[model samples]
Target: MSSPLVFIDGDQGTAGLQIHERLRGRTDLTLMTLPATERKDVRRRAEAINACDIAILCLPDRAAREAVGAIVNPAVRVIDASSAHRTQADWTYGFPEMTPGQAERIATARRVTNPGCYPTGAIGLLRPLLDAGLVPENHPVSIHAVSGYSGRGRAGVEEHEGPGAVGAPSFQVYGLELAHKHTPEIQRYAGLARRPIFVPAYGSFRQGIVLTVPLDVRMLAPHADAAALHACLARHYAAAAHVHVLPLHQPGDLKHLDPQALNGTDDMRLSVFSNMEQGHVLLSAVFDNLGKGAAGAAVQNLNLMLAQ
Candidate 1:
């Protein structure tokens, strides 16, 4: 049989460009993309999506929805890199290590929704603890994350690096309204009964993210401590190739975490730092926002779907 055709729609944006780079020169599948002139032609775009065996969409939420709606081929599968379908029941979430059998679910799914960059970190840290019942469902959870400017896509790049851009701030925190889109995804996948407070920030760097969720030991399930939380996450991701659970930190063992440490790579590191005397525990995830958070994740889900 001929090689399966893979189409990347909207490959001009930041996420799209990175995904194209990662999948370029592959021998297993036939890569396809429309000429720049025809990229926005609705008919042409629809045709390209339907012609491929698998379509990877890296577009804005509305455009991603439109692309999926235009698919007329019954055999065409999709991996959407937008927030459009993440909370939808019919779409399979594409975080392979989120839980047992999640990878298999993506492999067999016809429509898969790539998790948001921030949600990827938040859910990665929260899911296992919630699943193990070490944390109460109604605990007041607050998440804080800082990501490279690339998380804002091409616009951010232009603001920080383009000509005539000279006075951009070094750091800025957003989502002050408490209605950030990733909140729902984190709550649902992390299995929380109540909504959590999510605050995200953008740094001047090109890519990477450090997302942290602080917890109060006194509010957790009885007998649950920092060690139990660490062990639970360690056990959950024991066999996961992409997700790493770092050793629990002791006093004076580690001082700080650099968000850009994982730039250019798809691996994500999860760290648990605690102060028992103060009854405080902090969970953090470090990864390239453009890699594991976006393009890397889309490529990952694409690989799983291709294995079917």
Candidate 2:
């Protein structure tokens, strides 16, 4: 059979550019693109979408939706790297290692929605615990995460790295309005009945993220301890190709957790830090916002879909 033809819908944007770069030189797929003059032409865009064996969408939520509406060929599968369709029933959530058979689901899905950066870490930490029944569905969970400025995409990059940029703080927190786009995906996929309290922040750098969730151990079922929670997470991700669980024995001496530790690679590291005496535990996940969180993930899902 011939190599599969793949089209990237928004190939000029930050995430789309990264996806295009990652797919460069791949022997199994052919990358298709339209000329700049025809980039916005609806007919040209629709034809490209329909002609591909797989289409990866890295546009804004609205544009991604519009691109999907233009696809007339049912054979062209899609892997969307936007906030759109994340909660839709017919679309498969694109975190392949989410469960035992999730990879297969992504491979066979006609439409797959890539998980957001924040939700990638949040769901990675919470899903196993919730599935093991250590945390109830109605539990009040709060996630505190910090990302590099690249998480803001092109405009954020221009604001921070541009020559005339002004008033850029070393670190800042947002989402104070309490309604972040990733909350619904986190809540839905993590098996939480109530919405989570999500607080996100951005730093001076370009990429990577650190998502931390604090939990009170005493409130857990059967009075579980910190080690139990660690074991649950470690076991769930033991076989995963990208997610890694750090050992719990090395505590106190460890200095700090850097958000940019995994900037260029498509890997996520999860660690559990606990103070049983204080009855608290902090679960942390570190990854590249543009890698495992976005473009790398989209590529992974595309590989799965094409394999099918």
Candidate 3:
């Protein structure tokens, strides 16, 4: 049998570059990328996309949509790494460890939408709680997170590390409009009845994410406490290979988190902190934004698709 031809539609951007880098050493399939000179040639791109067994889109929303529309081949399956199709009903969400059987669904899907980097962390923290009913759907929730500048893509890299680079800032925050593109994706996938106020920021580093969501245990089902919350998360993720729940914080122990802790791997860590007397708790997820949040996720989904 012939090796499957896999094409990357936006091989020059941040997510695209990482996906390419990770796949470079693979020997199982044939990889395809348009030459730099033809990257923007619509006819050539469309023809190349139609020729592959599967296409992984790492382009902006509009371009990803255009590429999807240009596919005339009946056999072409797609994995979109843009926010464009994430909320669309027809597309399978591409986070495998997210829910039971999600990986199987991705394997069988013809159209899969990669989760946003921020949502990968946020939803990873929220979904299980929502599903376990530890957090009510109507509960007003707020999320705060910081990712390395690579969240901004090529421009971010250029500003932080390019030849013309300005020194990376120690810290920065954005999405003040309260309408970040990842909000809806997070809300919908996390199963929240109301919209969440997501406060996202960037740090001087290049790639990693630490997302936090604060909740009031008083808002949970009657008699709920920190241990209940922790048990729920632990139960839900116990069998998951890549996602984990850390041991609860020790009494009067260290109270800090470093975003760069898991910078280079696809694994993720989830931790729960709470004050039982006050009915308050904090949930955290840490992972490589460029790894699990973007390229690593795309590659993981690609493997599922290929296995089927």
Model 1, residue 132: distance off in Å is 0.5
- How do the residues 69-148 of candidate 1 rate in per-residue lDDT, one tens digit apiece? 99999999999999999999999999999999999999999999999999999999999898889988887899999999
lDDT of each: 0.93, 0.91, 0.91
TM-score of 1: 0.99
In candidate 1, stretches whose alpha carbon ends up further than 4 angstroms from where it belongs are none
Model 3 misplaced regions, further than 4 Å: none
Residue 109 of model 1: what lDDT? 98
Clashes in candidate 3: how many? 0
**TM per prediction:** 0.99, 0.98, 0.97
Clashing pairs in 2: none
Please count the clashing residue pairs in each candidate, in the order shown.
0, 0, 0
Top-scoring candidate (lDDT): 1
Assess candidate 3 and give its lDDT: 0.91
Across residues 1-308, which tens digit of lDDT does each residue of candidate 2 receive?
Answer: 79999998888878899999999779988999778999889999999999999999988999999999999898999998989999999999999888889999999999999999999999999999999998888889999999999899998888888875677777999999999999999999999999999999999988999999999887777756788888999999999999999988445956789999999999999998988888888899999999999998998899888887
